[model samples]
Target chain A: MQLHYGFDELKDIDFMAFIPIILPFFAVGILLVLIALIDLYRHRKTRKSLLMWTFIILFVNTLGPILYFVIGRKDSERL
Target chain B: MNKFIVLIKKEFVQMVRDFKVIWLPIVFIFLGITQPIVTHYLPSILGALGGGQGITIDPSMTAQKGGEVLASTLGSQFDQLGLMILAISMMGIIQTDKANGMLAFILTRPVTVISYIAGKIVSNYLIAAFSVAIGYFASYLYVNYLFTDVPFSHMITALVFYLVWVLFIVSFTTMISTIFNSQGIIALISIVFLIGCRIIVGLSTVIDFVNSASMSKHAMEVLITGSVNSKAIDNALVTLVWIVLILFVTNYWIANKKFNHE
Candidate 1:
């Protein structure tokens, strides 16, 4: 119900509070890596593009995986 | 009918042969797993970065007596499933095929354009459904493991609605893919539509009937909360209309156009 947390409350924070919020992003990040590896394996010849995607996905966080999902996975032919 | 079946079979074969097929299920499963995990952990991660200014969270108090926590958790998962993964996946499928000239080749086959388009739509839908199921189930299992007192029934209901909501997304993206040739363009358009629908729904109080057609409006009211309201029904119908219209246009384009094979 309470979405916002005050800065003063950080001192006595509970671990349970962190579990729900961070878990999804973490899962997404790992999944992105897995998907990238699969793509790399499939398109072995396109190592440069795959590597570029890997970096973009790792550094970009939530939007990174999304970018890869849309623009990154597209074939050279489409470009 | 025979030609349709053959086309479907051909499409399936191609899907299987392509390593990208693995990506389809993997993307969904990954999203499913991450959706809940991210929703649950995001606040804390932000708090950690805030250091001394970080917000304190009371776990026992927050997790204290209620099914609301589970509801929120599932709700967040659905958001990721519907908004991010489904839309992205749909565009990716269509764009990839087109980029590779697979569409051109497939068009030359004996099958009618309608059947070709239908088979592709069906395959993508099935894949999306399976991915969402996996994600929901995984989330449910994790929640059950974490909070023993939480009721499983709520999670089950949430999962059902979540899947139904994602169907709208899958259909919308499929249509977008059919209409748009470029992946970047389609992705941009889909994002705009996704965000635009939400904005329209939010401003519906000022704009009468506009809210009725917004997918987010009904998806949130019906599928997210498990309520079957008229608005939700309207949203579903609107999404269906888009799907039909897009497919018809795509089929017509393919049927009427002549290809030059070099």
Candidate 2:
């Protein structure tokens, strides 16, 4: 049984076809980045190395926001 | 019981405030989809990049069972990166409260130590389980779409076995967080130990019988072969025992006020 068609079919796959499939992936990523940015903006005064975190959150894709949340958010706010 | 509910409520509120409610499942969903998508595309990706010069890629080799792909989603993606993310996100579960004197403050409110520990474990376990389940389901959908369809019974059985391991992870991380002070150390220990258990799963039968990571293996086996290992229940019971021991240590640590190191 041909479990999958060969590379010829794969090569013929439309780039436009992938847009819908991959859109959710991008949406989740962008949502994470946006939430991290908004949180960072709100807590800008409490966090140290504000410029660095802002750069990380904007540039590092998905991991950057998670890093911000896990490490950066706990700077000096706990009282 | 009342205090336990209040504490669980407090934990969820804190999760919402921290954006954990938003990000954790999203991260899991991302990780879940990545395995099947990447596997499905890798041959074409290699063919496109390799210039058709030397090695021709075989499509038959790339053809994989849906169960095998789903199993890899747990073994490859969830075990390594997912474990690390869970550990990091939970590293401060108890450590933060201890550091900020919140543990002590909460204790002073006539709350027994058991309820406090129970609250932490129950709330965090629910979140962890929820995140993992969402991710696993995401992987299941993509696996069925891209590969052969796995049987529904096998999927649920594998998930149940895998969740036993996840329960151990939650309780173990909670214990480490309670006993340790630094988030870095807690994260490091939990990640190393959990990943180590996963790495050593098939080393020996004796070890497999006692290892919680074997539950992951059992899950993968169920997915791939559609047969549950007879020892799966035994391994699960052992894992539950480990969780109970971990929680006992956590309770003992807090009850003894051992966290008041100055």
Candidate 3:
């Protein structure tokens, strides 16, 4: 099996070459954060801990949004 | 059949309204790409983070097979964080319906108990399977670009096997949701048991035959070695049987109204 190594020397590696590879990862994360922030903003009246959720979603990265969606969003006043 | 279709449509509508359709796959996609990128860049990341200190990383030491990288995507990323996400997302599959009296209300309709149970499993399973597939495919792309090329046959076959294990996860969580009233308990039990099964996969052969998690190991083996295990077929069958058993328990619990914990 032929293995393609990214670089022979660490210093020789160009960070720009990696931008394409890493871009999707950041894009997905930012999209999630954006969606979460939007949802949290729209439901601010019903959602608990409004300020805290905004901070969590903005700063906590990927997991922050997920946590807010799963636990923070109450969905209904009756429940 | 029409009723089942309606139930499925209703589930899809609910998913869309709840934004589950949007986020679940994205989460899996994030997880899928994370493994390959992290593995490829760990050396540089560590080197840059540390003060050029004690442990220097060798690029040659980081050399890995595309198949190995893909397998770890399933073994490490998908199995741990992926599993938790799935369990958490699905923890309320039936519990929410039960909580809102929707299950009982729906049963009063012309729907059979079988159709009701089937609808829940089918819809949720599709989402779970789709998320995992997208994630696995993302990992495959990165693996091919970053490492050696895994054979087309190996990649496809490994995914088929891995998805069977995912089926078990969905059904098992559904069963727990059906029997338990609290989301926390359901999530806790599903995560613990599923992760436990994954953790004990290679301890013994006797356990391997009945353990649904063996399918995951079989998948990883196919990826790394480019050959299916002799026992993979039998293990898959056992896992299917386990899924059926879980579905049966879920159906039984719902039909008998055993979920009324209040």
Reference contacts preserved by each model: 0.28, 0.24, 0.28
> Per-residue lDDT of B1-262 in model 2, one digit per residue for the tens?
9999999999999899888888888888888988888888777676656554434556554778899999999999889889998998899899999999999999999999999989998998898889999999999998888799999999999999999999999999999999999889999999999999999999999998999999999999999999999999999999999988987888889999999997
DockQ class, candidate 1: acceptable
lDDT of each: 0.57, 0.88, 0.87
Better of 1 and 3 by lDDT: 3
Best by TM-score: 2
Tens digits of per-residue lDDT for model 1, B102-131: 777777776677777777777766666776
Listed models, DockQ each: 0.26, 0.38, 0.35
Q: Which stretches of candidate 2 lie over 4 Å from their true place?
A: A1-11, B58-61
RMSD in angstroms, candidate 1? 5.4
**Candidate 1 residue A72 C-alpha distance from true site, Å:** 3.3
Better of 2 and 3 by lDDT: 2
Evaluated on CA atoms against the true complex, candidate 3 attains a DockQ of 0.35
User: Residue B25 lDDT in model 2?
Assistant: 89
Worst 10 residues of 2 chain B by lDDT: B48-57
Chain A only: TM-score per candidate: 0.61, 0.79, 0.77
Worst 10 residues of 2 chain A by lDDT: A1-10
TM-score, structure 3 vs. true: 0.93
| Candidate 3 lDDT tens digits, B134-221 | 9889988988888888898999999999999999999999999888888899999999999999999999999999999999999999
Provide the fnat value for model 2, as a fraction from 0 to 1.
0.24
